[model samples]
Target: MLSRKASCDSHGQDSSYFLGWQEYEKNPYHTVHNPTGIIQMGLAENQLSFDLIESWLRRNPDIVGLKRDGESAFRELALFQDYHGLPVFKNELVDFMAKIRGNRIIFASNKLVLTAGATPANETLMFCLAEPGEAFLLPTPYYPGFDRDLKWRTGVEIVPIHCSSSNGFRITSSALERAYQQAQKLNLNVKGVLVTNPSNPLGITMNRAELNHLIDFAIDKNIHIVSDEIYSGTVFDSPKFVSIMELAMERELYNADIWNRIHIVYSLSKDLGVPGFRVGMIYSNNETVVDTATKMSSFGLVSSQTQFLLASILSDKKFTEKYMKETQRRLKKRREMLVSGLRNAGIQCLISNAGLFCWVDMRHLLTSDTFEAEKELWKRIVCEVGLNISAGSSCHCSEPGWFRICFANMSQETLQVAMQRMKAFTDSSNSAVSQQQFVNNTRARSLTKWVFQLSSYESEPHR
Candidate 1:
């Protein structure tokens, strides 16, 4: 009835990640109205720092009004803008990026390409980097959204570089070799490797050794390394973030072939708690790539007014610095609360230092050590326990029984309610049933009656 990608489930929004979101939306939990309904823990959104943004906007009404010192500039902001983006915003954007990375390296504004958001930025990169049927490797337990962002429209393929839980799901040289070999076996052309630093599902940053290994792999394979560093600013704890560029500089890969091959996908969505702004960027050493991306960016330009407002916000060094510290402080507090809540429920999560979510281990809760059992447990948690979380399987995790539970998007009271629900579910599931009995019991429920589907939010892959 339409294009093959459109006609198929390849877009990947129909799976556990999104289905849970559907269930949550249908009967969302509210303290006053629907306390028994599902608490949405599936989305990886940052809402903790909106107050700072509001405060800043309130103080700068002229910026908010697209005016300079009370003089209206609405006509200029409302008119068409170049795909190259506002020079002021791009300049400040890089400065913000540099400040986030502890100012280890400075980014060239001309080398940056602007897009509507990280999703489109990634897609645009895939369009420039690889052809249909070409593949890029990804680490397991990745953000579920990459399936749509990197592959859906581009016809690019994702070959998972499986990381083991034994090493905290850290990337290893052996995994890269295995993944590349696997791609070769499938007769696929390898384009590059895509990674999320302060990773999405795992919420941990890649160390220096791993970054060096990635550079080695890129050089050896003659491929690129697309580091999705949208969560760079979300790193709240120590052993602080080490950007791939920082390492590249230390190793002096600048202006080299390896340098040009490294591209970064960054966004204001997670860092600013403003997904509505739709401002994302790609910073590469390859000028041709930046130019090509800029041309392609016309298809998804950042609105000029949004750029004007952000330019005003970011240029205030004091405000941005304070905002950064405050954001980290709140994120750390929320992270501790979620972890504490889980611990109270007799659950443990991967020790994470960044991002809006926790990679929770409910492996002990499953009746069997298989993905089917994982899905079974996931369904029960989402449908019965009244919480929606992304299953590890959707993140292409090698093992079962892990889930991403987001804490930044909800209120403290709601989070407490979710903690209580999780505790109740954990307590009830203590007297575990055999796999057969578990399957039979789940079969007895009216699945369709409760999980009526209506869906988006680019759901976490399968969100």
Candidate 2:
């Protein structure tokens, strides 16, 4: 028998992406041995920038202290990093974040706390803000990892604010209020609201008005606001990325108190295409939160060697700027390709401006309107179609029949194949439906004819 907490730790097994990846690892599409291997479009990863990143790294060999600064500096970097993060790394990160957000936001190094990744950064914040069993309100169709990141170890709860597709899934004040009220009804203590601007799955960036509404709601309720901006640099189209830091500054000009409650989580994974590097940051104006999280970061601090290399790369103003522009250009190209391919297949995707994936509607293809039907369709797509895209249910979406399809995870060739597979699946499904309808119609007509003949015979004849 497991403890109650142990029993609750089911996110890993529950996550579709995890299961999909497991299958993919067993037989990847790129391998010759597995010709009909799975095409993994479920994980939000940016493999498009690998060539660019590799080129940049080659140009800056001194990042490893091979040329400049000698062996001593290299040795120093190889040692344990400060729990609060190396000063040089923090300074470079501050600049990198500002540059990506169009310099509209300024980050202070002292306020930054580094963790292994955004997952740990979020967990750190949850620990600092809420006690065990307390809740944070998240918008529905959120990043599925939040359940594990925020709640797994810390015992924090998530209350979802249901945003409907009718309104482009934008978070509204009414939705926030409804979630808060629902939390209250459940006797849960609501601590804060968590938002992913340039949301995961949906890939939509929240406009300024929506962000302002969030600020107002938090102020009215005196609750904390955590904005996860990990995908800040991944924005391709306009209504550009807005940082909570930028909003917090504007609010501070009038009311300084809100700064203490506003926190931002950022990472290098999506933007820099460096998930393996494990760089994540927590920037907060609250000194106490910063101090607490800094202390908590020791258990999962980034490698000193990784920090040193990234610091040097990020500090290179010219390379960093060029890299940002090129990354966005490639991401935009990939996004258009994926969206166009999906649309051509008669599949509709949510309007998304940023992020690595898009929210796709597959409801019409479902056997029914229920989540169980959604699961069945998801299974068919994975097992039959060999395309692994995440089901919206995994992301805590209120509605069924949606899935998040990652566009940047594969080569163009692989993506084309995946799209083709999706089209084939849809075509076959439609054909099956048409065949079933034809069979039903034929049966109905035969039954009607027999009934009419029987009525006519009984009326004329021998009674």
Candidate 3:
């Protein structure tokens, strides 16, 4: 028998919810032969914009260097991508980031490090920032994949800063303090705090105030702050995104140390709806982190061809600007449709303004208020209802009876079918509950009448 490392052995049983969802995708119920197909609302994907991207690509055949003038450019892009990334790619990325952040902040090419995707970017940061046993604070009800991205290989631990739903699951100072104290109690070295702005499960963007609190907390603790802003371009409403870079720039006027500790991870997967391209970047004001992560990029560098293709496309200011606007508009419309459909089914989701998914409240659907009960409900939703939405337990949500429903991954007709199934389930559940209540009421009334008759007979004189 081959002996594996202790880390691998200990974590081998820990399965990823995403990998499990893939199994469902392989032979999904919704195929041609299967009438009741599985409707997957679990994956955070943006399939809604594929047609637009494909059409644009078709219109611009020059993007592939197929044009006579672009032949040399295509050949150059087909070569090996540097660990530090192509300068042109880096330059275009900086401009794109500045544009999306409302141009309030600007990034230099030296500050950016390229990786395969945000997953590797996060793993690289974990390796660079923290030691094997150190912990990073994460706001609870976070993205489930963080476990695999940040901790699985790096040996880092995640200490959740439990955020409550009462205030829309917003991260608070008190929660930060509690998480810090809890880490201390466990005798773990707290190295940093990782936050996903335009959060994954919640789909809510953090306001300036919350960002300030996080900055202050990190400064006070003298720990690092890793801001995952992959969904920055997905914002559709108010409380617009405020990048950590912007905050650091403003603060550097008074305190320069803050800049040294801040790092950001970004990707085009969510924004461009090109997860297949696997382009991810890390931008940091900290020189040491920038250099180290750049060197670490050797393990998972973005393909040269992909970098070249994106660089050419992103450099087109007119196209990028228009694309961003249209993407947001479509996202907002889809979000509204999903919210309305769920509402019609009496399934209330947490109010969200960004990202591809929503935190749906399903506590009423659970058999009991426990993670085990949540798992059962998840099974019923997947197997019976044929809709594969993620369970709250899988996302490290402290509370049960919540799920993340991705709205941009399916067609309008498929989404409608999912809503119908959910509504049917809810209606059936309600009917069953009502019938049980009626049975209990009838039993209670019969018992009351029997007791009264017995008392009356006794009162008539010991009959």
Candidate 4:
């Protein structure tokens, strides 16, 4: 026997979103080997600007050698394993974050707590802010991994604010009120609200009205606001990504008590296409949280080797500037290609402007307007259409027919093959739906006649 935590299925990895990944791995589509096999569009990874990163890495040979200024810094870094992290790395990291936000928000290296990645960064924040069983309110159709990262080991609960597609799933005052009340009914102390600006599933940035409303609600409720901005730099189109700290200053809330309660989780996983490095940060004005999270970083600290490599790369302003611009240009083009391809298949997205994926409406493709139908449609898409995608239900979306289809993980030619497959499937589905409607109508008429005959027989059966 093992500990309950080890044995239990609380990690939430069995969700369909992840299962789709399994499906992709089983029969992956390759342009050369398996052109007709399933093409993976379920992962939110950025492979667009790796060339730039690689070019820089090639030039900076000393980074891997652990040498600075033609000398060795290996021994010092090798022996160093403090939770405080390398100051050079932190300084450069925070400065890089500022560059992503248009040099608008200046992040302090002192207030930043480094973790292995965004996953642990979020879990660490939950540990700092809430006791076990306290809750965080997340909007509907959120990043499904939150189920595990925020709750699995921490024992925190996630209450859905249940934003609707009516207003493009924008967080609303009414939805917030409803969610908070629901949490109250469950007798859970709402510790905070977590949001992903340049939202993971939606690929849409939160407008200022929504941002102000969220901050005000958090202030009124006296709850922490954890803004997960991992995809901050991936924002390729307008309106640009808005850091909560930036907005707080604009509204003069930076000087208020609310600023202390506002925490941001940032990572190079999405922005820098370096998930393997596992570099994540937590920035907060709350000194206690920063210190507590720093202590917690011992469990998932970024390795010194990774810190050095990143420091070298991020310190090169010329490379970072060119990288960001070229990255945006490529992402915008890739996004356009996916959008245009989906349009040819009669599938329209949620008018998203950022992120590596599109939250497109596939409700018309569903057999019925229900989550069950969403699952069925998803199964068909994955199995029959040979495309791996995430259904809205996996994201806790209340509505059906929406899916997150990623575009940045594969080549343009591979994407074209996927689009061709999607177009064929949709065309067939439209015909099948029409034929099924006729079949249903005929079955209804036959059932009515059978009922009349059965009633007449019953009336004479007394003999």
Candidate No. with top lDDT: 4
lDDT of 3: 0.86
- Per-prediction count of colliding residue pairs? 6, 0, 3, 1
Residue-by-residue lDDT tens digits, candidate 2, 1-463 = 9888767654556577577777767767763666598888987899987887788778767665534465457656666666978898899999899888888877889999999999999999999999999999999889877878888888889999999989989899999999999999999999999999889979988888889989999888889999999999999888888887787676663355677899999999989889999999899889999999999999888988888788888878988788888888888898888888888888998888899998999889988899999989988888888888888998989999999999898898889988888888888888999999999999999999999999998889573
Candidate 3 deviant stretches above 4 angstroms: 1-3, 6-16, 19-23, 29-31, 66-68, 253-255
Can you give the TM-score per candidate against the true fold? 0.92, 0.95, 0.95, 0.94
lDDT of 4 by residue, 282-386 (tens): 999999999999999999889998998899888999988999889888999999999999999999999888899999999988878898999999999999999
By descending lDDT, how would the candidates be arranged? 4, 1, 2, 3
Off by over 4 Å in 2: 1-12, 65-67, 70-72, 455-463
lDDT of 3 by residue, 18-89 (tens): 744865676575546765877778889887777776777888888765343655565566666669888988
Where does candidate 3 clash, by residue pair? 29-37, 30-37, 30-38
Q: Per-residue lDDT for 162-247 in model 1, tens only?
A: 99999999999999999999999999999999999989999998998899889999999999999999999999999799999899
lDDT of 1 at 75: 91
Between candidates 3 and 4, the one scoring higher on lDDT is: 4
The reply for model 4, stretches above 4 Å from the true place, is: 437-463
Q: After superposition, how far is residue 78 of candidate 1 from its true place, in Å?
A: 1.4
